[model samples]
Target: MPDRVYLDWNATTPLRPESRAAMTAAFDLVGNPSSVHAEGRQARRVIEEARESIARVLGAAPRNVVFTSGGTEANVLALSPGLRAPAGPVERLLVSAVEHASVLAGGQFDRKELSTIPVTPSGVVDLERLRAMLAGGPPALVSVMAANNETGALQPISQVAEQVRQAGGILHVDAIQAFGKIPFNVSELGVNLATVSAHKIGGPKGVGALMLGAGIEGPAALLRGGGQERGRRAGTENVSGIAGFGAAVKAAMAALDADLARVGSLRDRLEAGLRQTTGVVVFSSDAPRLPNTTLFAAPGMKAETAVIGFDLAGIAVSSGSACSSGKVQPSHVLEAMGASSALAQGAVRLSLGWSTGPEDVDRCLEAWRKLSLSLLKRSGETELERF
Candidate 1:
């Protein structure tokens, strides 16, 4: 087998060395964070330090950060109806049509009580539609992601926050994909709740956070028992995972600017290479997107087939969100963006990371080029074989 290039950072990033070291140190500590003994105090200190670090990175008060099992749980915790913010209690839910499967599942809300706000062809949330939905409903909890996990399309979160505020609705921004890749300030976004996952930012999986903005009360506890996380989430804390998350957050913030520039350039070069091939369409190309992501498709190409081809050519990519990659179906995100089923079925995503370099991009391009040629020949698309 040949060395493989990894271009699926959006699905989950490679763990940072800093995170690994932090986790390793945490693992050697003995004590439950809930205990009052010296060892317990040490464990608790580690958790508090991690909480403070993550809070500083997200521009939130340390007390407002509620650690969770992962992004899905963080999101679920934020969707509770009747949760109080400064405005009032939420009575319903409104989510962007292009939200992740976890968000689209209508967390904590019955199907009849949930409504969807549409997005434009560019994959941006439609403010007008959102306004109309809010107008017709009771105070709603509106959820929109900072960036699409599949296409990296950045939603109008700031604008959406304003709209939700005007409508007296609480806004929850799923920043799981955008947190370390882009500059994210929970206060600046004016969101009541923001979800972030550790693994998406180069920490280990199984740890995430729900950040509550100032003046916003934390949501009802999702898991009630031990009175952990200020009674917001109750469980024996995963000390090592939280330590890794803290380290990853610190490292990610420090290198954010450089990573953005480097990864964005790599993504551009890769996209330019793919565009040189005929019938390649870049999704959300005209919209504001995360610097490290490119979702593209070729006419007549099946995404699964293309993914397999890439793997065979010593490259790694994904057909869509890792959560839904195994399902043999068109992307719900693309469908919500008004993409034809056929085009959606063919879509593939390439997400870059801090470790991605020019050589990795070149290798991905070479593999894709060969795959395109082979597919074209089989389809007898002579006119499209120029690449």
Candidate 2:
């Protein structure tokens, strides 16, 4: 197979060297973190260090971080009605229309008890609508993502936090896509609950955590029969994966400024080139978004076909969020943003990473140029170089 440029960082990132080394070292441990034996103590230390790393970033105590299988699990666990502090049980749930699928499921809450908070046409949460919802309802659990996986639009979390708090509602932020890419701290953002994933920051998959505020009480466990994670999340830990997550967090945070500056510049250049193409549409261009993401579409283009064209051109992109990547459908996010059905169906996402370079951006633009030109010239059909 030929080497291809990777532009799907929002889906998952390549493992960092530091993370790889940490996982490799963790493999030597022969005991479970729950055990009290000598080997177990070492394993426990690894997990503790990982929790501490995440806690440090979230501005919370290590004891407040609960490990889970992945971002989805962590998000689901955050939806419990009792997952609040010094307050009564939550009677309602409010999730942004553009939230991840896991959050949209409403966890333990019934569908009838849940409501969707709309977003602006530019793909931002509608604060006025959210304010009205919070005011009209009982205590609610408000869920929102720090940055969107498809359009990378940054939510006005600080403002949302203030609104939720004023209405005596709890706030949960799915920070998986924004934690390492931008600044995110549970306390700093006035967030009571926040979840993050490992793979999104150059660590292994199947490992994530839910960071809780100090005032939080017993919200109940998603899994049972084990005493792990302070009895809040039951199950043996993914020792090696947690170690890798910690290492990746440290490395990513340490170099965040440099990565932001460089990757952001490449994205700007890539967008500039894409805009040069006639009839191109960039989603959420006017909104504050993650520095490394761009979702674009062309009139009459079919995203599934465009994705294949990019692949044939030795570049990897996606039609939308990774969860919906291969499916032929309109983007729910774009639809919520009030995009035309045609534009929503044809949108394609290209997300950059710390390892992306100027060469990769130029190559992607070349592929986009060829694909867009052909698709437009044919009035909908796609033609590209064959491998």
Candidate 3:
């Protein structure tokens, strides 16, 4: 057998060497960042330095970054109500239909009044619908992802943020898929809150950041304990993880353009190769997408079976959102894009990353050909029923 060809970069990336080295160095420092002693000060220095590095890469102020356990906690903390809300009434929570399960399950909003903004077939948000929804009621806090995790569809967050601001509503962007892969300027996006995960960018999995723009205050603490993260998130700082995250962020910023070109080419090759098979339709193919991701469906094939088939062939792939991997439900992202349950059932996602190479892409393509043949033969059908 050969090394596994990982095409699930959209789920998480392998840690970069630079990130690993930084984490190794941080492990030697034995001091609580919250302590006032010399050791504590040293630890604090490490944390702040990491913060500055991350802030520089994201084009945000160092003071605006709040380290969280990961993107889930960050998003939850960002959406929670601060100390100033009036008693009795809950704030409106507007979430896009294609949000990650983390955002959907955070429980930071009211379920009864939960407004879902629709997306176009291209996986872009229907701005006209959003505007109408905004005008239909009092201003509501809007949460939209910068990119669709499954389809790799890029959202018009800057324009959406502008609309939210004009409506006196706050915008929270789940930027887990966008941060290091694409250019992210918090100020330019005009979002009050932004969520980014380290694992998506070749950093440690347990570390993520919630960036808050200047002068904007968010909801109260989801975690109550010793005051950390400037009294926002409460926990002992993840020094090693933060260091790794900072290193990865800096490295990603330096190599983004080149990485984009290389990965984009590989993605194109993968999509084109899959298309040679009959009844293969690539989702979000007509939209602007993350350079390294492709979502496609093999008609008459079961996604679980295809995933297992690819895994057996030494290739790693996903059926839908990684967060919902073990569940049997079809992808909400694809369903939102008007894909019927049957079309959504056969959907597969192949995402590249900084470490992806031509050989990996070729290997994946070869595996797909073998699996599709076996799958179609087993089903005794060449085409899947259209919705």
Which candidate has the top score in TM-score? 1
**80-121, model 3: which lDDT tens digit per residue?**
544122121226777888998777763476576578899998
lDDT of 2 by residue, 1-387 (tens): 567899999999999999999999999999988889999999999999999999998899999999999999999888998666335678889999999989999978899999999999989999999999988667889999999999999999999999998888889999999999998888888998899999999999999999888777756788998889999998889999999999999999999999988989999999998887766789999999999999998778878889999999998888862334545667889989998888787889999999898999989888877777777767743443221
Q: For model 3, which pairs clash?
A: 80-219, 81-219, 81-220, 82-219
Tens digit of lDDT per residue, candidate 1, span 331-358?
A: 8899999998888988999999998889
lDDT of each: 0.89, 0.89, 0.84
Evaluation by lDDT, superior candidate among 1 and 3? 1
Candidate 2, residue 291: how far the Cα is off, in Å: 0.4
Per-candidate count of clashing residue pairs (backbone under 3 Å): 0, 0, 4
- What value does the lDDT take at residue 175 in candidate 2? 96
Model 2: pairs clashing at backbone N, Cα or C within 3 Å:
none
- Per-model TM against the reference: 0.97, 0.96, 0.94
What's the lDDT for candidate 2? 0.89
Candidate 3 accuracy as lDDT? 0.84
